[model samples]
Target: MKKVAFIFPGQGSQKIGMGKDFFENSDIAKDMISKASERLGINFEKLLFEENDKIGQTEYTQPAILLVSSIANAIFKETSNIKPEFVLGHSLGEFSALVSAGAIDYLDALELVHKRGKFMNDACAGSGAGMMALVGLDDEKVETLCKEQREKGLKVWPANYNMDGQLVLAGLKADLESLIDTFKEAGAKRAIVLDMSVASHCELLQSAVENLRPYLEEFLIDSFEVDVISNVTAKAYNTKEEAIDLLSEQLINPVKYKHSIASKDEDVDAFIEFGNGIVLKGLNRKITKKPTLNVSDMTSLKKTIEALNE
Candidate 1:
């Protein structure tokens, strides 16, 4: 069998009714959601199914997305016999990756990200931080431009190494608010300021990194059930010791997803995003010409299984 890598998405992928079908149809999935609600003292079904702003808030969004993605991963395991050769997650999705690898306990991963979200939200409460996607500029140009702009007091940094020409920049809201024209003037096709209030995977979340250290120290994580890639380093997290500091530093460092994917491209034959939305599949299309799938629901799952089986 050719190796397959499973990539789990981060915070932005969450939506209402993401895993409602799994919760309704599978005992294991139902028990998982129920446990999450009981443990977090929040009604996941209500928060995830209803039309509310709570799902948009970081504190609620983190745990909710984690539960749904993990449950989806669990359902994927139950419904199919295929096993992924490598696993990775982007930013908040790293917890889901760790859970898939068995490096972090599922419930512990859930609670940790919950607190992690609160810490990040608390850290950014008054900073007026923000992020934007700068498309059509290569990594070097974007990095150089961001560095130059930062010195001029805009303080922008490339936050996500998404692909060849797509970079997500994070910095102060006022600084990013003005970069639209400047980037377009500098040759960017589009400078889309994201709706996110928190500047994730950047120095803005340094306080969250500090606040999350203790939880990492306390958690009794097991060795990997499957090899997992790191977000900050874009390398394999071969041991639990490496995972702890990297997980904490993820809040403060840029997400090097392009490098991580490149590291596995030669080794893996298929790339599957096993969570909400087809974000990673689109990203994979940008990163490589691999056969990719997004298995968030029944349709995508069936398609992925059929392709992989064939």
Candidate 2:
């Protein structure tokens, strides 16, 4: 049997009109959007389709992206025979993965992500914290560079180990600036700052993690039917307790994505990036030379279905 995995993208992958295709064509998509609007008490549809880039703030973007991703996953389940053997998500996308795997209900996931976005936004307010991507550098070299910078009063650290030559760093604005020259001096191809407001996956998010603890404790999570990989530890989480704990700790812990992707079982025949963009597909290519598909729209979904059947 050929195994398939569903991968979900995180915050930076969100764009206006992400799920608009599915919303117009699929009843499930419409219902999911409507429910998200009612639960969050905000016009999620309007934010997704009408707001353009203005609503890309943390509070709105997190839930909006997750909602779009979940709808996409639902569409696949309803329309195709392609069942996922394993599911994984990047950063905030992990919530979507859990929902798709039947570990958490859609409403609970929506509310949790909404609250999580608010917590993250609150923690980052007035901190001058941000993220930057460093290209063409190995993980060890980047870690060493960040440590050296930290010794010089820079708070920078490896935040996302995205792929072989790509890593995201998070810390105070000044700290990032301080490392720019060093990054270039170390032969980095590019060291560009991302527009993210928070220094996520770093100690700066400890306050947000603390705020999220209560919600995790209160939510009723059950064991997942499908294997869901954890971003915090880069391993499969089987029990409800482990899932809840990983969800809470993910806020402040660095994403072990490299290990997670590298550890995927050899039985995986193809990888499908379930929503938004080709980010995960790109990362998958770095880890293994496998065929990867990206399904963010109806056309892509049809193509993927045909390809899988072939």
Candidate 3:
């Protein structure tokens, strides 16, 4: 079997018709979506398939994304014999990774992340929370600039190390907006504050870390059936003990995504992203030379299986 890593996408990947192909074609997908809606007391069919505003809300967005990604992974597993060398996910996607690895059940993950998103939203509510994407700046430069801003009592901090010259920042909205010109002047080709209400993966989320821990404890299994690389440390973890700590800390730590992929690139012949979009696949193109295949729907799923089989 060809060695590969399975990856999942996080927030910013959700859309109106993410899992429709699976829902329309596969009974398995239909059942999973139905169960998720019942478990969460939210109509996932409307949230995932129809046009609505709640789908973008973080609490709803979390479970919806997980459900679709889980369905995609589940359907792929049914048809493909290839197993991953390891698994990893970005931000909210980490819980989906846990579900795929058998460290947590998919229903439990949906509930956990729904609460996780609520906690995150609650933690940052009214804090003027926001995020920014900075392109064309190196890590050290961005870190130094953020440190300088923080020394002046600003709330900005590096939030995501997506790839070389692409870093994201999280903090108060005004603070991030204030730095746009500063970042641009400092060699960032583009620096724009995202229209986000939650400041993720930074000290702004400290309260969320504690709020999310109990759920992690309650939902996670004893150990992983397949090792998952952590977004916090960019390292492999298997047991619930490690998962609890890393996953909680993940709330307040910048995702080391570029590091995680680059460090493990050679171990896998390719990557298969199970989700609604090619977001991670796009990132992998810049992070590693290894090809990334995605199973977002029936068409892509078949294509990915064929590619792997070849």
Model 2: ten consecutive residues of lowest lDDT: 215-224
Instruction: Give one digit per residue, the lDDT tens place, for model 2 in 132-221.
Output: 999988989999988887788778989998888889999997789777888988989999988777888888888888888888766547
After superposition, candidate 1 runs with Cα above 4 Å error: none
Writing each residue's lDDT as its tens digit, candidate 1 over 193-245 gives 89988998888888888899989877747578888898988888757778888
Clashing pairs in 3: none
* lDDT score for residue 70 of model 1: 91
Each model's lDDT comes to: 0.86, 0.85, 0.93
Using all chains and alpha carbons, the TM-scores for the candidates as numbered come to 0.96, 0.96, 0.99
Ranked by TM-score, top first: 3, 1, 2
Task: lDDT for model 2, please.
Answer: 0.85
Candidate with maximal lDDT: 3
The backbone clash count of each candidate, in order, is: 0, 0, 0
Q: Point out the worst 10-residue segment of candidate 3 by lDDT.
A: 216-225
Show where candidate 2 strays beyond 4 Å.
52-54
Ordered by lDDT, highest first, the candidates read 3, 1, 2
